[model samples]
Target: MSTVPKRFEILLVSEHVEDRGGASVEDSAVRSAVVEATGRHGASGYPIYEGHGIVADIDPETRTVEALLVDGRELDYGLTALVRTAARG
Candidate 1:
C-alpha cells in the first residue's frame, strides 16, 4: 500500500478519544464517536470538498474505522496531510 491509500483503516483506540475502559475493545461509544466524527459534514475539523468526499465506515466487530476517499480532483499535499492526520486520530 502507498503512503496514502484509497481505502485505509484507523484502529479504535483510547488515545484517539477522551475516555476509555470497556470490557471489550469494540466499545460502542468509541465506534459511534469515530463514525460521526469522520463522517460527512462531521465535526472532525477537516475540510469538506464540494465534489469530493471521504466515506467513513465503522466495524464494531473489528473495532476499527475505515475511510474510503473519493477524490474528484487531483490529490495534493494538503489532502495527503489531512488523511495522515485523520489516520493518526
Candidate 2:
C-alpha cells in the first residue's frame, strides 16, 4: 500500500527594500518574508519552515487547508482564524 503526501498551506509576506536589479531582488524579497514570518509565527511552536519567503505551518497529525498572504494581507478570514487558533496552543 502507498500513502499520499500530506498537504499544508503557507502564508507569504514580503517587502522589496531596494532595487537590486535582477533575480537576486526577487530572491532577497522572498528571504526577507520568510525570515519575518518565521520570527513572528514560529513562536507558536508549530512546525514552521522558511523558504523563498514562505512561512509554512504544518502538523503531521492534522490536515491544513491552503492560504496565501501577500504583503501582510489576509485574503481569507476563516483561514486566518484557523491559524490563530492553532497558534494559540
Candidate 3:
C-alpha cells in the first residue's frame, strides 16, 4: 500500500516600505517555483502572502524542503528567519 502525500500551506508576506523605493520580488514567479519544489518533495504546497514575507505550514515529518529559490540559490529557513534575513538584505 502507498501512503498519501500530505498537504501544506505556504504564505508569503511582503511589505513595501517607502524607503525601499518600492522594491519588491515577483510574487507570481515565486509562488510558481514554490509549488513546483513542493511537488518534487512528494507534497502539495499552497502559497499565500500577507505583507512582505512568507508563511509556511509544513508537515513536521518533512525533513527537507526548498522553501525559496532565488538567484540560483535555495533558502531553507523558517518564516521568521527568512523575514529577518530579508530585512537585513
Indicate which candidate wins on TM-score. Answer: 2
lDDT of 2 at 29: 30
Rank list by lDDT = 2, 3, 1
TM-score of each: 0.19, 0.27, 0.21
Name the lDDT value of residue 65 in candidate 2: 25
lDDT of 3 by residue, 1-89 (tens): 63423333343333333353454533322332122113333223533222223333233344233344333344434321122112211
Q: Mark the regions of model 3 whose C-alpha exceeds 4 Å error after superposition.
A: 1-5, 15-66, 70-89
Off by over 4 Å in 1: 1-52, 70-89
Residue-level lDDT of model 1, residues 1-89, one tens digit each, is 41222233332223343444444434322221112232333243332222124344333234233333433333232222122123344
Alpha-carbon local distance difference test for all models: 0.31, 0.35, 0.31
Worst 10 residues of 1 by lDDT: 76-85
Give candidate 3's root-mean-square deviation (CA, Å): 11.7
Model 1 per-residue lDDT at 64: 35
